[model samples]
Target: MSEHAKLPQDLDPDRPSGARIYDFFLGGSSNFTSDRMLARRVLAVAPDMRRNAVANRACLHRVVRMCLAAGVRQFLDIGCGIPTIGTPHEVAQRLDPSARVVYVDNEPVAVTHGELVLAGNPNAAIVRADLRDTEEVLTADATRRLLDFDRPVAVLMFAVLHHISDRDDPAGTLRSYLAALAPGSFLALTHLTADHAPEAMRAVTELLLDSQHPGTPRSKAYLESLLDGLELLEPGVVPIAEWRPEHGDADLATAAPLGYAAVARKP
Candidate 1:
């Protein structure tokens, strides 16, 4: 494992973080040298990392749009990284002025950035919390202030699950969150998987595991099991690029590695 230096609340100039590495991949400047170094090393193994990030981000946008169409005005985005341009709150509020959103991230930098981005928006707030602790996440002051559990809520976990290693019991964590939602609520997720590109994807996973954010990628079967009790929407557990893509893909034969997106409803 890499020995990383600690970073302050405002900036972690020495240590590498998953959120910052992701930001670097997305061409954002919020990351430090350590993060960029790891990002580059992982990219050497998986050249499609950039494409994977973009496809998952697009899926996030599409899911949010679908939520708006479905008349969901309350959103709880867990494991949301440093807020960049066109975040969930920005998109949801544009769709409905009354829309409320709460962003949660374990990284202090992520929470700080989210707070700044959401400043002056009474309907939105940010909290620093771990996704593994579903109880605290759902019942936190920020969640209570911005979301009403009595009403339908759209919970988003886009491209964040892969970071939750197998030992963490990702399924159990998801179940706790799902159990807390009201009927008619929704669960939208985009996770990294190696089922499609085993060799290359595994190399990336191993690299990340040795880096600051330790994690493991799951197979399609494991991912499907995570949605056991919920009713999956159309195109269940497919490539993110294939999930209601604004522009349909002419070729759906080859599967995209390092990404899978799906949205389910709790009945």
Candidate 2:
């Protein structure tokens, strides 16, 4: 709603975008004042927004490495925000040179920046599309060009599903993406939740609800329900900070708003 900032020609600086806000939180320079202001407001509500963002980002890296370690090199990253440090392509390709990734986002700024960062990387590309439109996302020219449907793919939807409203049928969206993957494919997700967080997070959630990135925090049970048909990995769905935390949570805010993280495999 804060629209008093400068944006790129293809972007509306006045309108706050989730990707830009996320970029701001990630310590990146791809966001505008409107995004920073909104991010700061959420920070006021949940003082640990930075820690929560770090935990969510850590989950993304872990999931990518986890899938790659399992020999799944191709990734279909839906709702991929603005490219930042340690992005999927960066992590995946560093571990395995042949790792292929198809990043998808609805924001023009994110897609534009993502393409710029990924330019000349034959194994990675970005597609601008809504995550809710599974058919279009799965069948896009870029997606088909960079990935093979018959092989196992790691479909990543990190910290984005909460932005999808009930009317969007988030559960069906998960199913649609899963149905498009091969038998050995995987679904990894990390979504915001108020289940184990402080009451202040509810205010933050409501604030975001009124913004361009309207999000609804689901319960732990509901978060797991999205992966009902798939086989969940060990540790199940837990707080993002606790999901295979490679480094000790020395500085992690234990009281940060919980963001549920989990990965399931298709049978």
TM-score of each: 0.92, 0.94
Q: Write the per-residue lDDT of candidate 2 for residues 139-197, one digit (tens) a residue.
A: 89999999999999999999899999999999988888888889999999988888877
Candidate 2 error regions (>4 Å): 1-8
lDDT of 1 at 31: 79
Clashing pairs in 2: 3-14
Q: Listing every candidate in turn, what is its Cα RMSD in Å to the true structure after a full C-alpha superposition?
A: 3.5, 2.4
Q: How close is candidate 2 to the true structure, as a TM-score?
A: 0.94
Using lDDT as the measure, the top candidate is: 2
lDDT of 2 at 112: 81
> How well does model 1 score by local distance difference test?
0.82
